[model samples]
Target chain A: MRAAGGDGHPGPVIELNGLTKRHGGKVAVDDVSFTASPGRVTGFLGPNGAGKSSTLRVLLGLDVPDAGTALVGGRPYRKLRNPLRTVGSLLDGGGAHGSRSGRAHLTWLAVSNGIPRSRVEEVLDLVGLADVAGRRVSTYSLGTGRRLGLAAALLGDPEVLVLDEPVNGLDPEGIRWIRRFLRAYAAEGRTVLLSSHLMGETAGTADDLVVIDAGRVVARGTVPEVVGGHASLEDAFFALTEERGR
Target chain B: MSAVAAEWRKLLSLPSALVAIGLTLVAMPALGTSTARRLAAQLDAGGDGVLGTVTTLTVGFELVPFAVLGPVVLGVVIIGSEYTRGSKDSGGGRQITTSLTAVPGRGRLLLAKAVVLAGVSAALAVVVIPATIWLAQTALGEHGHTWDALGPRVAGAVVYWMLMPLIALAVTVVTRSGIVPMVFFVVNSSFVSVTHLLTRVTPLAAYLPDMAGTRMFTAQGPVHGGLVMLAWTAGLLAVAALVFTRRDA
Candidate 1:
């Protein structure tokens, strides 16, 4: 049996307690909450407009939540000095400008946070973009852009990784690499919170699940725990999201 | 300090910004000489020996309508360039998001930008002031002001060109596009007749940033021209700070 109280767990490194966000008259996230613990891959699954991006935005301090708190490392992300060195994040589309060269884009981000210039090259190599680093981002293919984004995310070598749809444009090889890399990253006692609708794909990687729909967490637990006697992870995901929480 | 340093690096790296700097440096001297000769001809026709006539340092104020164009573009380029593309939220392309995420302190980030703008403006002035003086003296020869007489004009010219664009920068913040301010500055600064007309209706229009900035060189300018320029800049910057902090990136 699993251990009970006094499990000595450090609790979650990423916490969203009673997070609520509204867009004018519309409610984006209605008091939804969850935690991403260390040394495990926590999958954030949802349908389109399910408030996945909104939650990530507030968590990263890109957008302020109307009510509730989103904290990283037990402190608001805004308070950290050179936050990239603490929580590396990869938002959708990599937040890149087409006119800026891939290397130059990373250079400014590195410079802004006072990260070493040499780290720029290191990340370029890490993301397998070393040869094309000098080319303008406009010419980059979607997969290439994703690799560049990943490179930027790894530039600070942060302990916690927050990624949104990171597997979107990757090929099978790229997806497998990410799966292996994220798993290995979690194995190193770091926190990995990945949001994607790919249930079966995430099944082999994530240690826990956070299924959200209609601006609330409908189901969240270990792989099978959320699956709960269902035929497969996807079946469980559909039940939790489409069926409006059984 | 790091944020400020990084902003400087970003300022230098921008290609459009480099073009603005190059244009201002080249055009100031190229146009200043021709302008001095024409103004010297005007002074002869007007029959006056005004101590600090616009022709005293032609490049400093006489042909300002055109000279101001380059620096004005440079100002607009500094802030508007960011909004040209990728400010959209569809992808992670909004530079503001990346910038604010890294800096977090909205006020400090904009202040760093302002400082970079000021530093670049001053550097350009360092080059433009001397070159324009030498060129104007050579072109206007006997018609030009002497060294002692030309001192304040040189100081005035630098401060004027450097501070003028900050007004445009603040406007760009509100418009969120450089195009609006760029067009407005180019058209407004190109022709003085419109300003003259506006000043007739409201004499205090003389205290506008452009006019107040010009006073740094003109004989008829008010005693508090610098303070007037400072007030406008401070007011606009306060607006930018308010809007930038309260809004969602």
Candidate 2:
């Protein structure tokens, strides 16, 4: 899936073109293309087995691609001058050092990228983690861990944000906060690409959508455009997958 | 400055790094005192080595902790913790590579890790060295033997300890686990007893990392034997660095 909103280049801020990845004999993500642009929240929609994480991994340069390319700002993510500043990403909350304090985790990231230490404080406050930032991550709840992950991504004040299942285990309040936060993030001329299995949570927040099924792009367009003739986002998604399977 | 600072922060913050250093500090003095007394007793009986009984004991037990999983475990943890956080492919190596991709000079991070590991290992050795010397002298009753005479060999011992961690870190980077390399280190590297025996039959045993590294503890040496050991340590570390830079992290 591609993130939209390139800086007037007519190209996307994030792009995946004919991307194909296979693990041994089994194909994980087949040839697919999508773009996420700035000024919008582009939801990367797919079912349980739909290569959502795999595609994200490829875009983040975590997984090697057998075919095609994954790019940010018209260049590969790995080719960026300062990746943390150009693009912010939160892949897995489990990535944090459990024994290290949340503040330390962000501090290392900041220092690694030449960002100021104070940015760590700003992000911690932004994520509502300033109070408990000194505590070890091993003590954090799943929700709190996700927030710390978010803080890390925002440390660079990046131009583009990529989040995978950001609200997977958030409470209702947390979920609402993320929805508003992401929309406001994109509204400030930044790009946001989010992945989720829940169709409802995404329907309200996403302006554009890319639906994938079994490693293929089943549909892609504005929210209304994709669901134009369907009853709801779920109905539209089901219809698209059903038609693709047929 | 930032790259070094970041690497240093990572080393200091890691719990295992602290534990490893703590253990080395506590163990060295205890080991030195016990061995000093043990050696004095053995010498009084029939120990026959020109370098003295203290030297013999030091050579005999210097590599034990690493052989038993101390340094090897620390090495594996440095790389393995990244894998435990997520997919091994995207953990520490990927994170570093991604950072390097942005900077376009990936070698610095590798250098940074090596520098930090080597720095901490050496600092720990410095602390242990004096304590070991003091305890050994006290337990042996002032024989007027100075550590200054053992300077070259002591330097080599500290370097050997530092190099072991780097080699282990490289193995963990490629393998992405704390267990596999530790098992390899134990089953393969520490099978030195068998190699020691093989030396009587085969000349090739002299070049192995285990045999060659042991020569670093020699009390006073300007011989070809110590140089051969230095070469072995250099060889292993070079191979690790080459593999680390070329592979897809």
Candidate 3:
């Protein structure tokens, strides 16, 4: 049931223009630019240390880009009022404190954005973590913690979803569940931008693809367009990245 | 206001924060009682010198400085918990990412946390100061002072307790980890007060935050001491806000 935000209104747009970030003397993201539009699952693919996390971090206002802009609905994340209600993001273990119960973790997040506490239970049930929501997150398995993180991301029922490595830790069922959930979510006219190194999964689930290597976008287009002349998306990924490497 | 409410909920939900409060509640009074009992025994033996001159009010006031350890821990944990990493199996993530995304505005997030820290520490002081005073007074028996006699000193202790946590908050923010500030503050509060020792080496040490803060309750110039400690807190928090807002999370 795509009841939440399924009114056919286009969700907020995520745009990064000439974005550059540096850590110490090294560049993490270099002149990166792309758009993740409503009604699309844009799979942000990259090798490890390819600046996917850095770009997402800047977009979420967790980091300051040395130059350029990362914006949601034409405003910087830091400038958005009640950002969570507009953009729900999952970055690194869902940003949860280990000592807190999953419900408590989501409760504070909801309270921060003035979201009704009832939504906490709804998201918990939606993510299938209702029975163990009261358990400390430290006790959760890797896959369970990922679900908890996903639960938090959906807590605010935002217009845009930004997730880094959303399926890093999940069983086969979980993988299938998220694949279906994200498709339904985007079908409701919401934006989804997820970063992962999983090429096969990206090929199967994502409508659009943006690939980065060494802090630069090497390719961008629909899944089939980027996979041009290649046997598969995985083959296309290696071809593009290896060529850049040389 | 919603941000503040979120911070309050966050601090309360942390098991470590709760444990710190519980331990402070039980430990502060116990420590006060034992100290008061020892001082009373020393006086009963007809001891001459500083021991003989110690009044019940003095006994109660002496315990106030040590009461700071609780607030220090509370402040440290409030911010420290944000930086604590989950297990490796859990993607080794920290809560700071979630916090930043929810609040977005760095200044607003830091302000919310400071407000919650101040509120909790002040509330803790209200419960703790009186409990410690009452227990210490009881242990002093015939020489015990009434609550009325300790009025302003109790107020000073509350302010002192409140400010100490803010100082801890600023330091923890700058350090971004609980280890350094936790070790330094806990050691200085309990075992050997490096700040206290520095006072003997140089009079300027009296102007230090902890020493000057203790003067709020123990010395003759309560207002002066409170102001000095407030200045230190304000200065450090300014630096913390700058560092926090300008840095990458």
Q: Which portions of model 3 miss their true places by more than 4 Å?
A: A1-12, B41-53, B146-148
* TM-score of candidate 3 relative to the true fold: 0.95
CAPRI quality of model 1: medium
lDDT of 2 by residue, A196-224 (tens): 88999999999889888998888888888
Q: What does candidate 1's lDDT look like per residue over A1-246, in tens digits?
A: 111111244768998999999999899998977888889899998887889988998898878899999999899988888988888888776666666788988898898888999999998987789999999777887788788888878888898999989998899999999999999999998999999978888888998888888888888878778888899988877766666642
Give the i-RMS of model 1 in Å.
3.0
DockQ of each: 0.49, 0.31, 0.82
Q: How well does candidate 1 score on lDDT at residue B47?
A: 48
**Clash count, predicted structure 2:** 12
Question: Which window of ten consecutive residues has the lowest lDDT sum in model 1 chain B?
Answer: B85-94
Q: In candidate 1, what are the lDDT values of residues B1-249, reduced to their tens digit?
A: 878887887767777777778887888787777777676676667745544533464444565545656666766776776565542323445566567667888788888888888877878876887787778777776677676877776777777777777777788888878888887887787754456567889988887777777777664453478778878888988898888777776
Off by over 4 Å in 1: A1-8, B37-54, B63-65, B87-92, B191-197
Per-residue lDDT tens digits for candidate 3, residues A142-243, read 989999989888988999999889888898899999999999999998999999999999888898889999999888878888888999999999999998
**Residue B183 CA error for candidate 2 (Å)?**
4.8
Error of 2 at A87 (Å): 1.1
Specify the highest-DockQ model's number: 3
Q: Pick the winner on TM-score between candidates 2 and 3.
A: 3
- Residue range with the least summed lDDT across 10 consecutive positions in model 2 chain B: B86-95
lDDT (10s digit) by residue, model 3, range B78-145:
89998998999898899999998889788899999999999989999999888888888888788787
